[model samples]
Target: MYNRLTLATLASLPKTITRPRYAREALRPGILHIGVGNFHRAHQAVYLNDLFNAGKSHDWALIGAGIRPADRAMRQALEAQDWLTTVVELEPGANTAQVIGSMMGFVPVGEDARAIVNALDDPNLRIVSLTVTEGGYCIDPATGSFNPEHSDIVYDASHLDAPRGVFGALVAALRRRREWGLAPFTVMSCDNIPHNGSVTRDAVAGLAALVDPELAAFVHGSVAFPNSMVDRITPITTDRERTMLTERFGIEDKRPVFCEPFRQWVIEDNFPTGRPALEDVGVTFTPHVAAFELMKLRILNGGHAAIAYPAGLLGIHFVHDAIANPLVRGFLDKLETEEIIPQVPPVPGVDLHDYYRLIASRFANPDVGDTIPRLAQDGSNRQPKFILPVTRDRLESGADVTGLALETALWCRYCAGTTDEGEPFRLDDPNAARLTPAALAAKDDPAVFLNLRDTFGDLADAPQFCSRFGIALKSLWREGTRATLQRYLNDGF
Candidate 1:
């Protein structure tokens, strides 16, 4: 019989399972991390757990905090187990489970940022990290810049004390710290956005600029926002995973995370106060992390976007299944090899083509069980960050974007709320209200979808892109996803 996973039962877990070798009682909170989602638990928390296991950085334990309502559910679940998480690494041959003890505590969840802001005000907290998804940075999707005019930014700026979003809470906390003569905490972003640290700095300092220009200046000058590239194919937790944990390891973890065996972290070494010795555990810390970050955003994340829509429209459930299909796999292979890789600049110590091969192999891991739906969600946010930049780069360099255009057309078609087989599925984007109507309209008038200025930006106005996008979208509606993919593969647009 399985026992409930808690600090009480942690020592009794199966001998085959690996867990923290250190004492949780010895851990001290030095970092307050926002958005404690599956990826954070799998990637950042895992690295810290390794660091602590090596008998170092005990004071840098993570204090998980979040501003979203979903975080409340996460807090409740983890609180039931004394803030512990069971992470299962799935390999083709065998899987393993571990109870990560990196997170020492979780902040109470609420709409207003009071609780999170209060957590940030702690003097012991030297670094305030975030995994608040790509869209959470208050960025203008079209411009790829900080949007001070965002409603959340406006709310947080005026209501500094009872801020409504992450940036507001950060502003409030930093302003208070500056007044108290305390140094501003380092703001490290683990999101997938290009130049994530700079983007985060823009959001936080930009919000501060609205309330107090002096505070904005202080935030800009004092805080360190280090760029980092984090990789792990962590799928959402389900009952299947819970059962596997119970059956295989005799542990009934409420929120067990299942991910692939591969994990990578390349961080820019810019922390002013201090950081854990993650390097000892295999994290690459360098003076320049831009090349690594760009390579990942373009190759790995961009590959996910490339395959997501076609798989979703074909009713392929699992990511590996999509990759296993000859047509889908062919589409991804051709697109990355031709259009995507050429646009990527050379990294310091990496070969772009080899990196693409590794990404494809990872995507094809059946044990990972990553769903097409998870990847296909939030295109409005993802497309801008992943696909469009490459498109813009190709267009600037006077190269044809046939594969890029097809990828975008596939996205537009996916937003139409049905598969090729007439199966209706919910459009999962936050902009569904806008996207659905536009997608439906695009079936008749392809330009209608491109008019989403916030998403397509001036790319909609580019005659070449518009022409290819129009032809690709019409072809999909006329010939269907598979045929359209096959046609693109056989002949160039």
Candidate 2:
């Protein structure tokens, strides 16, 4: 048996497993991160750990907060171990483990969110970061605007004093800061959405607008939402990972995170009330984070979207196994090289082709336990963000979107709730009820699936894209995924 991970047990950890070098007690809270998930731990928290180990940014430690019922479970898990995380790095040759100690505490998870709002009210908490996923922003896909009419937003508007959601809590805190004559903290977005900073501003300011236009103006004018691109293939931790932590690393941590060896963060330098010197530890602070953001969103994220449905439809479980399939890998290669990469503008000092190669290699890492279902989940939000933007660019440029159309068709086939092998799986999208029936109906007329104006928007009305999508969907229904992918590989169409 292994000792439970805590500050005391840090000294007991094996020499191979790295633990925090700095004094945990000396670390102070400067960031109130809303989400405490694996990606945040593996990416942002890891960066802070590095900065702290270098004996800097002691006051810039993180205080985790959340707005959902699920956050309570995470809090319980992490708090049990004294807010320690055993992050396992899965690589091709060897695996490594580290215990990160940057998070000082978590706000109590509750419906009223008074704890989180109160935490945000502190002036010392200068940066408010988020990894709440792309869908959590309460944005309408069709209009590309914040949906203030959303029930959560509507509820938060009336209950600003005891807001239930993240934005509501932020508005409450900002309102308090304004009245108290304190400077507003920066709102940083680490999620994978294009122009994420601007999107976050709209969500927070839009919600504030509902309460009072003046409050909205104050928030819009004062708060700085910095756009950022964060990359780390962190898979959901299952019992297998927990078992690995015990067997391989000799750490009995309840909330261990398993991720690929590669991690990156590119941030826009816009923090008004001071921030961590993340640039000292490999973080790229830039004025134009958009180019980097777009390149990653299209190539890395879009590539995940491209491979996920095909792997899911083939009944593949792990991401490595899916990419290991020659046909599946070939489909992604062709799609990115011909259609996807062509649409992405040049990112400074980075070759687009080289970046795609790196993405492919990362996906092919077998040890990370990244699941196809993880990538496959949230397609209703993902497709519009990852896949359709490329489709839109290609269509507008009068370029052939044959590979993208095939990718879309694969998503539809996967949504029909069955694999090519006739095994049924529940669609994991939030809009599953609407997507499933539409996908089922599309077997007769492909336009039925395209009519999800919320998803496809006016792209359904384009003849070029529509015809290609219809033909590909029909082919998937008849020839199956394998044959269809082979045909696309053979014919550049």
How large an RMSD does model 2 have?
A: 0.9
Model 2: which residue pairs collide?
none
Provide the TM-score for each candidate, comma-separated.
Answer: 0.99, 0.99
Candidate 2: list runs displaced more than 4 Å.
none
The residue ranges of model 1 lying beyond 4 angstroms of the native Cα positions read none
The 0-to-1 C-alpha lDDT of every candidate, in the order given, reads 0.92, 0.92
Candidate 2 TM-score, true structure as reference: 0.99
Writing each residue's lDDT as its tens digit, candidate 2 over 1-493 gives 6979988788888889999989988988999999999999999999999999999999999999997778999999999899999999999779999999999999999867899878877889999999888899998887678898888899999999899888998999999999899999999988998899999999999999999999999988889998888899999999999998999888999899999999999998898889999999999999879999999999999999999998998899999998999999999999999999999998999999999999999998988879999999999999999999899998998999999999999999999999999899989989999999999999999999999998889998999999999999999999999999999999844
What's the distance in Å from true for residue 21, model 2? 0.8
